[model samples]
Target: MSETRTGIETNPFDRDHYDYSSWFFWVEASEEQKAEQLAQQEQFLRVRPDSSIGERCFISPLAAIQVETLTLGRSSYISGHAYLTGTLLTGPNCTINPFCVIRGNIRLGHSVRIGAHTSMLAFNHTITDPDLPVFKQPTSQRGITIGDDVWIGSHVMVLDGITIGDRAVVGAGSIVTKDVPAGAIVAGNPATVRKWRVPELAPPTAASVPSSGPVPSGGPVSSGGPVPSGDPALAEQLRAFDQMVREQAEEVLARSWDAATGRYVDAPGHAPSVRAHCDAIEVAAYLTGDVPSQLSREEHVAWLRGLQDPASGMIAELDASGHPGPRVTDLSVDDAHYHVLCVGYALEVLGSSLPHPIHAVDELGADGVIALLDSLPWRGSPWRSSNVADMLGTAVLWNTRAGTPHSAATAAGLFGWLHTHVDPRTGMWGADDPRSGRLETVNGFYRTARGSFAQFGLPLPHPERVVDTVLAHAQDARYFAADRQNACNVLDVAHPLWLAGRMSDYRQQEIRQVAARLLADALSHWRPGEGFAFAADSGTGRDPLAETPGLRGTEMWLAIVWYLADLLGVSRSLSYRPAGVHRPEPAGSLTSQ
Candidate 1:
């Protein structure tokens, strides 16, 4: 008999219909025939009554799960027609639906649900070679790790090596490529955080949720909507300071960004700094209105596009006009990582505007950015605190927006490793140098690390200790190398001050006073007509420093102080008071290349 005569005619060649459940649709059968089918399914089952499954756990007769490598807690069930392989573990009350292909090393916390048609694989292929077929490529066997109470929706693809945190929901059809922070509600092709799941005990407020504005740009200031924190006085200050900063930033843009050449100028006698160009474009796009008339968005997009190596998402370290250059060999893993972030930020700022569609800045989108991040060199050790912090922070931000599943466990693991190196008294992790033992004194890096942890929703083991160290340092006259304002001290001072305002309730008042004093000390160096000087004593505090009419670094500092003040003063939602949004701190100048 023809298959169509026996059942609904379905193409056997369809990959989508190949799961174990396809048996049912392949033939239409009467009730008596269905009973025989069920019996046959049960007879073919590999699971024994003595298997690891607990009492009251239901495995549908039609399901085909490999019993030997699987372990299920009490009351957990696998829906019918699912094909599962590899070492799988699930806690109590878990529900895995049919047509799911879950394989390799996988773990699910209690009350987890693996929706129908969801596919999660634990390994990936390396296709870097041009000559070889992809299947012939080397494979990487990194597993998937999921936390308790997670809800994965149907049609979701949880890629290899990704981690989904507890209480997190993977929206239907999201492609998770990186680690997801706990309690995040993410949805998209490359998942981005739609909102955070607040604890039941917490008061209802718009904390951590994006403000309804022209578009969601991550910063203290809301360009179109109501100011996030409703403080009229601070709002006034922010407006005045934001205007000043915009003007100075515009000046930098005019001088640095050459529309014709698509290159940012550098200090005399060297290549135009690729890093500087990207940083300026990102900050400019962020600070300026969605469609600023000063420069064409298309031009900026074209410039960024020129830098990309299409085959690989790697951005060149030098522009066409740049000389004495950073050839491909000179491009370090660190440079690539930072530039990728810069590009992502620019795209975010560009795409997030009202009425204006998310224009693709270059061939590279969020996925391209993820590719760059994934390509970073893995250094195993008591890992470098800075690298770990940077990677984790960047991953969190990217995953929150892109919906890519990076590993949350991987980030948490790195954080745990970082915790081991922390100075208990200072609450600061040490420098990257392995030899720097317990006695090594804290430096500016401590402040940056603290900020990264706070921004990324990671706890600073002992924040008060770090705050205390910062406060003590600011009180000393030697905080600035020679009482002259420099970028280093400005940032070192700004990070803690900003954190205190943004993170601490009781210490806000104290931190504000210190910040005011520091701001005053730095401002005194401003030579009205000449703008802020690099150094007043004519000493080079940072290498190759020079006096200039305008410096991007200095402008960044003044703008940050004003922005932080506004942020601290705003009457924030109760949600933000506990831990502020994951938005990048403006004074995170240390993050600059």
Candidate 2:
């Protein structure tokens, strides 16, 4: 019965072949499969529901899952692969670029742009135990609000509970952990505005036009490029300068002595001068060779009280007006020249010398000083006048003061008023009339003030309005000149420009590049042999400070170096290890050999 074989290959179109077809047919015919197919068809129809989209409205196939949930206004565009979850409540004309991951509650205003691969996460975690795993922690949520015309760069990560103000620019790769003030350009880990956006030129009118030729260089003149020659002799001079500085600093430190009240003071002759006073404080604190006393405790509180000025909430410049003289003219407080600087210097020294809890002077008990700062009318008009630095210095002091909520609000308001008068063309502060509030007249003041504010954590009020005005004036490349008269040459300029780039969508790349370049050029001027020169043209007789470089110049260079390094994200290589070999203290330390 291995029978006469069937000549045909067992009904090729019969049960065996039909069974494969039957399997697929039954599976396709199932209710679940039919429902899924119908759902997919519905999704396609929903995504492209209508072709009439608003201006700036962007809808990518990858980005739009439930298209009805995504609403946009005029001139806004969304790039491919941008995953937006939760409610997308937006205003007019915004841009959502490719590869952005946005989740939870979010609200954006007009003309906003979200760069590629940026993450806006509106969620946080609560950790109760020091040893528990992070995944087991409870989660909390916070919404994100972006004001009108905000430009956010690629790789920006904005955390929960943050509000980005109008016309603000977020630089590439910035981690925003706090709220950004309106019209501010904020960058870095906990983003802050380096500068405000301002216009290029003033309005052309019958009275305002300049009658003279091109403005001559005010401070130092150079060919406006990188230094071509590298002089080893200059390096030697720098080394010599460093030695001079070290010796001078040491001499100043030696002159500081303990008072009857146990607080440090400048000895005799050193007490009358502003620099000497500052130096004494700084040096004594460094040389104390003791851990800072706990500020909240009785020991530190008593020490602070000894330094306070009972009448004015200010510290006296010296123990006695003069050693042997009858008149107090030598150490009189009425000399306005350096009074503000002295106050700021003392506050900074006290803050640094105290423990962490007492770092804020306002909280440590200094109401009179705060009141005096508030009462002083804003001077230093026409930008480069003498009192400008004092205005900025006082502002710094106020920002660091720790006090009641009302006090903080007052400080914030002062800052707002100061920023309101910034020159739109030059990004400088200080005008003849603070109330006139014209940007063109106060360019230099604005530039200096902007830098000072960047160091402290004060928010830029109305960032969008400021930026738009500045950018309008930045059309000329000469505005980016690395010279004293312009904002580009000084450290103030660099910091603000860096901040502006981080916050704005329009000039992020340009501003960062310029800032980096300026920093590099300035640092290159540092001679290993001599201390840092005022400019690249120092030895060439092109720098104004070359003939008489002193503490002011040197301090400025050091501060700039420290800040630039910080902005560039450079970190110290040294690490603390309990088991490692101990080394001698640094020469700057109080107990140096």
Predicted structure with the largest lDDT when compared to the true one? 1
Q: Residue 431 lDDT in model 2?
A: 38
Model 2, 1-593: lDDT tens digits are 01111233545344222112222322333455334434643555466332123432334434543322344444455555677765455545566776788875466755678888899985567587768887887554445667556799999999865667555789999998765645557788877655544211111232322111001111000111111222345334434533454444444343343343333333422234333334333332322211122222223323433443433333334434422222222212444334344434433333221111112223323343344434444353444431433333343333333222234443444455456655554444433444434333334433443423432323344333344444433333443344322212354444343344333333434443444555555555543323344444434455454423232333345445433332332201101100000000000100100
lDDT, candidate 1, residue 314? 44
Q: TM-scores across all candidates?
A: 0.48, 0.36
Could you tell me how far off, in angstroms, the CA of residue 187 lies in candidate 2 after the best superposition? 23
Residue-wise C-alpha lDDT for candidate 1, range 264-347, written one tens digit per residue = 643223346655565455444334322233455545544554554443344546656652234232224455545444554443
Distance from true position, residue 533, model 2, in Å?
Answer: 4.5
